[model samples]
Target: MGEPAPLAVAYDEGAVSPAEIAVGVAGLAPVAFVLPHSPHVRKLRPVLSRLGRVVQLTGRPERDAVLLRRLAPAGVLTFSESLLRVTAGLARTLGLPHHTPEVAEVLTDKYRQRERLAAAGVDTVRCRPVPDVAAWEAALSAVGLPAVVKPVHGQGSRGTFAVHDRADADRVRSRLFDGPEDTWVVEELLRGRPSGPFGDYVSVETATGPDGTEVLAVTGKHPLTPPFRETGQFWPAALPHEDREAVSDLAVRAVTALGVTTGVCHTEVKLTPGGPRIIEVNGRLGGHLNELSRRACGVDLVRVAALLALGAPPPPAPAPPGRVYFQFNGLAPVRPGRLRALTGGDEIRRLEGITGHRPYVRPGDDLPGGVGSVFMDLLTGDAPDHPAMVELLDRALPLLRYEFTDGATTWVESPRRAC
Candidate 1:
């Protein structure tokens, strides 16, 4: 009889597309996708089916565990934050290797993450979880003004605020909390140079296997927009020898402390005046960095993640000093409006150093918070140098136009003007 088909499983939260991860996993073995019923997944079913089996996720631990066992997967993979716990639970149930559910909890919840890091002697900001308005006031007072208040389980900078005083605190509190059901954290803000090559923070992308953990690349982030939204990121962040060592060392400690034994870890660190401090650790490849690594340095993180899941060694990633630089610009609208239309696609796509162009908003789509579709992820590009890359991005902004409408009126937006 022919050997049984190699089997692997993936949790699709329909958050970011898992195409890269799924494709890589399929290269080694057939993959099965699990999702909690979404039209998005259903529409992509045909394309995903070509990669592997697609299954409905029932949201019941025991029932899902039975389905996973029936599939007899050799490993499970997930990149969605909400699905981390379920993925780990399934792995545990199947007697397969995975990060424990407890560790997944620590990675997903900010408060728990800080507590665990502190216990491991890692320097993290002073933080407290406040569940009510009264507690929010107290936590802000205790942590001091200019503190950051963010959802304990938040992502993408949503509901994260920098409260500088009582007025700011009260304003954010009224808008942020609905009831005691809300869990938030207030912490002292770390100060860093406003302008720098690495901006104020950096993320270390590491891959771990049987031998040990490898710090594959350090990515430099652009300065965040107000309220802490990441606007852009560049790969192979140039760091001084000492800074690089310190950041990489802290990344290792943070991941080891959390008991992440396999797969990829994305660790963010603030370059504070006191040195690097752990911000948070993610149990998946850094968003965009995965593709950036492949485009810029020839390191395919998705492939590495898949190989690790299947208990195989990934190919060695070539060290930097390569020919191309990789980057992406997340175009977040500064005001909310209905997207009427987009113009200049052909011109923008033809720009030098421009690899691709994608618009996240559709004509007539409602744009909220002045930010257009926050879910809109743009493109990945390869340029010859930093300046040329920036120029390329700048040139595209002028070529394209966003025609939008509010309830009262309509206007044409040249993103170039905003930038």
Candidate 2:
């Protein structure tokens, strides 16, 4: 009998769970998961163990490369931005299919990505890396007011903020610049559509391989809070056909410019009056996008990513008519406090079009307000239509509540925005 097809997934603790991809791949072929040993990953091991063998990853890329070489896996894939370079290095070491390590580096660093996009004639906002206060002032000046300041190598919007004026810039600098002279990028904020309900931004999900790139789906993003925290996301975003095409075109250009010969990517673009501008090109699928796309369209992006990793062609991205809208709402607290009590999970589950519900924090956990942090749980809803989806969330949100203790004050508070 022929030996089992060799495949391995380099795992990282990311915003979206890796279970879907791992589970989907396990069904197709025997797989191995390589990840760093940590308490958080330890808890996930048992659940992932059901899907495939789990291997402890040494922090060093060379060591991990040696291990992967021994496994002799035919393909390797990783979803974490932090691990992209390392994965590319290992893939190169194994003489497997992969974009060069330099390309991987370009994808993770926003400044490098913007540079490449500009060189390729793709529309991009003015951005520069600020390694110190001198460069920070210059970049902010060049970018102008209403600029975004973020770490050069950051994800999940951890050290990201919008600076409206000098005071805002000072605050952000003071907060983020204290870490041994870290690098940050300052860029002009891309203008969103004036009349759109939510700020006009969409992510193009694509699967690129030896054959070429395929546009899987375009997902829309909701308005963000201060510091650009995602409030919610829904699929089948109301966009004009031309605008969608424009975004897709730019995504293809950006991917090609960066020399991404193979793999899955999530490219974000914001529609401006002039045209569509590239927000950022992500090396892997966008967070919560895989689930949203699956419900909105009959396409499983996790499976697609896995197939691409194996140097196989995935099924064409289904263009199912938008019959239902799938939305993921961020359930985040408004202030810092200790979570005393929470409720409404049962009621929320009973609501119509409820596809999935999860609470990430437990009672007594400290709530730190940020992009992904402010929330203890995520609520996903599926509705027959967009308006109905909004209505369903309105009704379901009131039932869920959070009780927190700040200093001597204990109060029950609702999340920032309902689904």
The global C-alpha lDDT for each of the candidates, from Candidate 1 onward, is: 0.72, 0.76
| Span of ten consecutive residues with least summed lDDT in model 2 | 368-377
Cα-based TM-score, every candidate: 0.91, 0.93
Q: lDDT per residue, candidate 1, 165-185, as tens digits?
A: 888877878876663338899
Best of the candidates, TM-score: 2
The regions of model 1 sitting more than 4 angstroms off are 2-7, 13-18, 179-181, 313-317, 370-377, 414-419
Q: Deviation in angstroms for 304 in model 2?
A: 0.7
> Clashing residue pairs in candidate 1, if any?
333-372, 334-370, 335-370, 336-370
Residue-level lDDT tens digits of model 2 in 1-419? 97686677877776357567765576667778877777767888887677777788888877887788778887888877777887888889888776679999999999998999988887667998898777878888888989988878877667678888888888887776666437889988876767334656778888899888888777766666655666667777667788878888888888988898888888888778888889888887777776776666756677777778778864566774455566555555556778888898898898778867788788889887554434567788776666676667667777878888887898886654421
Which stretches in model 2 have alpha-carbon errors above 4 Å?
15-18, 179-181, 371-374, 416-419
Q: Over the full model, what C-alpha lDDT does candidate 1 score relative to the true structure? A: 0.72
Candidate 1 worst ten-residue window by lDDT: 370-379
User: Any idea what lDDT model 2 has?
Assistant: 0.76
Candidate with top lDDT is 2
RMSD of 1: 2.6
